[model samples]
Target: MRRLTKFSSAVVGLTVLAAAGTAVAAADQGDDWPYAHHSAASYTLAAVGDIACEPDDAENAATPASLKCGSPTLGGMSAEFATAKQATAMHPDAVALLGDEQYQVGKLTDFEKSFEQAWGGLKMLERPAPGNHEYYPYAKKGDNEAGQNGAGYFGYFNGHDQAGTPETQGQAGDDTADKQGWYSYNLGNWHVISLNAECKSDAFEHDCSTTDSGLLGQETRWLSHDLAANRRQCTIAYWHQATFSATTASTATVPASAPGAGGAEGAATDAWWKLLYQHHATLILNGHEHAYARLRPMNPAGQYDPAHGIPEFIVGSGGEALDTLAGSPGNYDNPNVVTAQAGAFGVMKLTLRSHSYSWDYKPALPGPGFDSTALKYSDSGSGTCN
Candidate 1:
């Protein structure tokens, strides 16, 4: 494989704003590119989301007093380091960070002091999506109605990392990014999309498919055109929220409070999934559940299909904290949910080929709870392009 060259993605020779898959300002052109895939036809990718434990400082608006970094084993600072360490070791062609890269209130100080310390190492190689936390205001507890907004998030990636200048970040994908929080790039033979899932109306968050319009329909429309113009045989769409979830018997006990994974996010809206499925997207990755789940191939209507459906993965366990299983395994009789596990902090690496892809999940050193539990999660397999 050779280094990817980014011509105008919009029109054949146009600079920006093309259908979608073709308008990249710059492709990843990975650090290890050409060398990493020197003699291979595929590229490796490290993908995860809900990353970075709060710094317990100003970045964490709610915990203004807990400035000291907490234990390196659990909810404090363990997951962030572990996941980043694993992703770096793999030397992937690109890292797709689903969302929630920072915690609590996603302040600029948080990204620099906490997230930048870990995952920032892979920022250049990352194709990121904006999470609900990016649009959410800082909340002392319940809903975040007044907070830092996404200034820190946008700036850090755009080279303007500082407080008060939160909006400085501008576009969400990366530098040379667009302000709409969405963009596309090429990786080897695959076309990848980094989308912004936080749709808003009157300064409040809404579902991606909300009929309220406002800032909701932009990405959906862009994605539809992008898919229609994609020339690649395989494609992947990633964002902060999951379009489908794995449910277990004890799931009811698990809080349904995560708005990003629920009504305010993509899974509940189904608009993104509908578009991707219609275009024959190969995979959908998300990180809002704080766990690792891989479901069977399925269509937009929630039915199984061996050949033409999209396979979804909920890999929110990039650190921050671990969430328990959705419920007892028995509660979910749906055969669609192939593998699901909670309390494991790790990263998922994908080997992207011209016409297929394979995934390997490696868990980090045991997090908070080390013993008395059997590790049952094992996700690794390859699937063909749609």
Candidate 2:
């Protein structure tokens, strides 16, 4: 009998006890590493999205002023923050972001506000992917339409958090970073990939509109190589925007009604779906839909095609603006889905195991106190492509 010890710090409300099996990040590094084998073995991966936080100044200006500090409109941002603080206080391994890290449009100021508000407490185990709002156009020299949009995002994250490693952080522009905003690392037994959605159009032949090029190009090639290179039993990849979502049809939903919703889907459309399917990704986490929605093991077409169905979790409820919840769970066609509260603000917690994974969605609530009901919906399923 042997005892395993964890190497990475516990993040937010995650717990990683290496009392058994392999190293979690070994999926990328290898079995000989001194860590838990799979995240299933050491810890669980938890996520939240569309966590629209209100800057302290904005709090005073919210519509329904009573719930301003923590309200459905703000995706209960303040509440989720406290909940994450509590969860991490419970001693968890790591916390992840699904995207849409902020609201309105992404700018340096917006990111500063986001960090000050939503990202205030969980800096310990913070990892993220970019959502559409994070890509507000910034005019770069040569690339006008494709000017350096996510400058604010780049400035804030700079790829990975290097506070622990001086070598990785002190270098100029993340030259030490694996790639621009895409990289892989091993933790526990999981091989995790964080990609930038803004780069989805980097190599698209057509305008971003008519291409399935979200995580394509060099990123896709790298992802394929990364997956093939690793032999770990579990792999997880997350991005800010999803290639497939039934949340709102362009014509019917409020987003469509919003001023700039027309080119929204074109942002990261279907580019990553095929690659994910091809790589047999075990779990795909994403945000941007403002509500929480979990797709059954699915394929490129958004169908319940289970043969290689990768369980996709849309945990975009991270204290942001709540989109209209869809009327029903499986209805991807309805246009007027104001009742679709699945878009409430919150986060998802995943307990990964060697052979199975379980996920729970915790939504935001008014809080001078926390609610156990926040942990209302929970689901567990066996590994599919493993």
In every candidate, how many clashes are there? Answer: 15, 43
User: Over the stretch 1-386, how does candidate 1's per-residue lDDT look in tens digits?
Assistant: 11211111010111222223223343333554323333247777789987776676543444543322584444456668878889988877677888888876576777778889987767656667767666576555343434544555776665562334534333354322223567777776788888777664223344345344544565577778888988988888888766666633223332222222344554434777788888888888887777787776777766776667777888888877666665545454345666666757789888888877788875774556754252435567777785
Instruction: Give all candidate RMSDs, comma-separated.
Output: 7.6, 9.6
Best by lDDT: 1
lDDT against true structure, model 1: 0.64
Error of 1 at 316 (Å): 0.5
Q: Which lDDT tens digits does candidate 2 get at residues 156-177?
A: 6543344422223311112222
Candidate 2, backbone clash total: 43
Could you tell me the TM-score of candidate 2?
0.66
